[model samples]
Target: MSLRSLFVDFNSYFASVEQHEDPSLRGRPVGVAPVAAETTSLIAASYEAKAFGVGTGTMVREARRRCPGIQIRVARPERYVVWHHRLMEAIDHAIPVGRVGSIDEVACELVGRQRRREVAEEIAQQVKNEVALAAPGGAIRCSIGIAPNDFLAKTASDMKKPDGLTVIELADLPHALHGLELRDLCGIGPSMEARLHEAGITTVAQLTAADKHRLRHAWGGIEGERMWGLLRGAWLPTAPTERGSIGHSHVLGPELRTPVGARAVLKKLLVKAAMRMRREEMLSGAMAVRIRFIGHDQRWERDLAFDPTDDSRELLRLLNGVLDSGNRRHPLPGPANATPLSVSVTLMRLVPRTQSSGSLFAPTQDTRRVDALVDRINNKFGYNKLYFGSMQLALEHDAAPMRIPFNRVPDTDSENEAGHDPLWLQSLNRFKAIAEGEHRRRERGGKGN
Candidate 1:
C-alpha cells in the first residue's frame, strides 16, 4: 500500500497563536484559559509549559505552582478563528484538504506520485513553508504525518512534535503503534480507555490483537470494527452528518459567578443559539440546561420536550420554568458566595421549518412578525444592542460572547464588529460565505476520498 493520506496537527494551537502574536511570550511558558481566574483550567499551553507538567486542563493556580514564571492569558477565540482561516487558505494552495478533524487538525488526500513516500514528505514540507509565509505574527509550526490511510496518518501526526514530519508505511502495521499508549490514539479518551481496559485491552498492542467480535463487544457497536480495520491500514470512508443540535457553553469569570450573573449568561447563550437555529430554518423539539457549581460536586440539569418551534419567547419561557424548578429544589447562594462555574444550553431534536406543523398553542402570525422584526433590528443595529432584558447584566459585564466552533464558522459581522454598517456587513457576509464554503468542503470529504 502507498501513502494515501497526509495529516497536519498544529502544536498547542491556541497558546501558540498567542505566543506568535506577542513577542514577549515567545520561548516562555504560557497557558491560555477561557476565564482569567485561578479557579479556571487552561485550554491550551505552550510547549515550554509542557516541560514543567503544565498543559491543557491544568488549573491556572496549579500551572503557576508548577512553573512559577508561567504566564496566563485569556483565550481570544476570534483571533484563533482568524488564524485558522489564514492557515487553511495557505495549506489549500499546497494540497487538497480532505477533511478538518477539528480546529487544529486537517487530513489531506494524496494521489498517484503524491502518494509516494519521498514525494509525500516533500509536499508536507511545502505545507510547512506555506504556513510560515502566510502567518503574519510569526512562524506557526505544525506536525505532519503520512500513512496509507487517514486514521494511521492522524496517529502518526500525534507521534511527533512541532514542525516534525513522520511517515508510517503500511508494512509496519500494528507493530509500529505498539509503543504508544491507548489514550495517545485518536478516539480513545479516559472513558473509552477504561471500557477497553475492562475488555482486557489495557494497551495498544492488546487493542490491536483483539478480534473484530471482541472489539465490537467492547465498543458496543460497529465503531470497534472500524478501529480493528484501521489498525491494519484499511481505508474507511466517512460522510458528513447533518446538524442535530445547537448549543453554547461559557466558563464564568470570577466576577460573574453569582447566581444572578449565571442566569444572565445562560440567557445570553440561549438567545444566541436560538438566533443561529432560526438562521438555519430549524426548530427545536427539546431544550436542555446544565449548570455546574464552583465548589459543589453535583451539577444542576433540567430537560424538557416541547412542540417544535423557533419562537424565542416560547423557548425562553420553557427555560425559565426549568430554572425555577432547579432553584426551588436547591436555592442559589448570594453574589459573594459559591455559585455556578459554567453554564450550557442546548436546543436538540430539531426539524426543518417545512416539516414543523405548529400545534394549537403555537406562536401566532403577530408573534412571528415581532420575532422577525427583532431579528432585523439586531442585524441592522448590533447583536447585543437589543437583546432580552434578562441578559443585560451579563452583556454589560461582557459575558457569553460569540465564539466559532469547529463544526460551524459563525457570522463574523454579528460578533466581531461594533457597528453594523450595511456596506461593511455585506462585505463581512462575503467573508462568512468563504468560511462556510471552506467548512462545507471539508465536511463533505471527511476522511474519505
Candidate 2:
C-alpha cells in the first residue's frame, strides 16, 4: 500500500483566528463565545485555555471558574471567513487542495514521488510554513497527518495536538488505531458505539476483526461494509450529496428572548435563506419554523409545503401565515410570560429555477426581479442597507454568524453583517451606486416593496 492522502486540521480555529487578528491576544488563554454573555457556550478555546480545563462547549461562567484570566471574546465570523479563504489560497499554492472538509480542515491527494513517506512529510511542512506566513499574526496552527486514505489520514490528524505531525504507513494497519476509543474514529459517535457494542464488537481490534457481513448487519446497511473496507485503507468513493435545505439559527440575547423578538429574527433568517436560494437559482417548496425555549427540550415548530417560489415576499408571507395559524391555537408567550431562547427558519424541498413551474396565483414578474435588485444593492453598499422592514429588530440587535454550513465561506458582502469594510472581498462584491433616494428611504424605516 502507498500513501494517498495528507490531511490538515487547524487547531482551535475560532480562537486561533481571534489571536491572529489581534496582536494583544498572542500566547494568551482565550475562549470564543457566540455572544458576550456568561450563559453562552464557548465555541472554541485556545490551547492555553484548554490546558486550564476550558474548551469548546464549556459555558462562559464555567470557563471563568476554571481559568479566571481567560479572555473570552465574542465570535467574529466575517473575519474568520476572510482568513479561511486566504489559507485555502496559500495551501492550494503548495498542494492542490482535494476536499475542503470544513472551514478548518482540508485533505490533499498525494501522487507520484510525493507519496513517499519523506516527501509527504516535507509537503506537510511546506503547508505549515505557508499558513504561518500567510496569517497576519502567525498565531494559527494545524496538525497534519499522512496516511493511505482520507478517513485514516483524518483519524491520524486527530491523534496529535497543535502543530504536531504524524504518519501512518499501511504496515501499521489496525494496530496503529487500536488505542483510540470507538468515538475517536471520524464517524463513530455515541449512538454508533452503542450499536457496535450491541453487535458484540466492544473494541477497535474487534471492529477490525469483524467480517463485512457482521459489520454490515451491525450498521444495518452497506455503510458498515464500506466502513469495513475504510478501516483497512481501501480507496472508496464518498457518497454523493445534494443541497436539501437553506437555513439559519441564532441564540438570542436576554433582550431578544421574547415572542416578538423571535418573530423578527425568524423573518430575518428566512430572508437570508431566500437570498441564498435565489443565488443558487433554486426555488423552495417548503418552509419550516422552529422556536427553542430557554432551558427546555420542548419546541414550537411548523413545517409547511408550498408551491415552489424564490420570491422573498412570498416566503415572508408564508412564514407569517404559519405563525398566525399556530398562534390562534396556542399563542406564543411574551418575554414576561416565557423566555424564548432561540429561533430558526429553513427553506426546503428545493428545485432549480429552470425546473420550477409557473404559479398562476403568484405576483407579476417584478416580484422576483425586485428581490434580485435588492440583493445586488446590498452586496454593493452593505448588508441590511436596503433590507425588509421585518428585519429591523434583528438589525438593531445584530446577531448572526456566517458559519452556518461549515465548508461554505461567507461571500462577505450581503451574507455578512453590516459595519465591516468588505472592500478586500472583490471576488463576491462589486461596489455599485444604487438610486440614492429609495435606499435612503428604506434605511429611514420604510417597509420596502
TM-score for predicted model 1 compared with the true structure: 0.88
Per-residue CA lDDT of model 1 for 5-60, tens digit only, reads 99999898888888889979989999987655786667788999999998766767
Local error of candidate 2 at 189, Å?
2.7
Report how far residue 230 has shifted in candidate 2, in Å: 1.3
lDDT (CA) per prediction: 0.78, 0.77
Candidate 2: tens digits of C-alpha lDDT, residues 1-449: 38999999989888898998887988999998767888667778899999999877777888899999999898776777677788888888889988877667888999999999989999999999999889846689989999989999999999999888999988999999999888889878767999999999989999999999999999999999999999998877576688898777666776687777778888887887887888789989999888766534466788999888888888899998888874364446322255676777888999998987847776578876798899888778866679889778877887553443533545555555521222221211111011112223333454333
**Model 2 Cα displacement at 212 (Å)?**
2.3
Clashes per candidate, residues 3 or more apart or on different chains: 0, 0
> Which sections of candidate 1 miss by over 4 Å?
136-138, 295-297, 326-338, 414-449
Per-model RMSD to reference: 9.2, 9.5
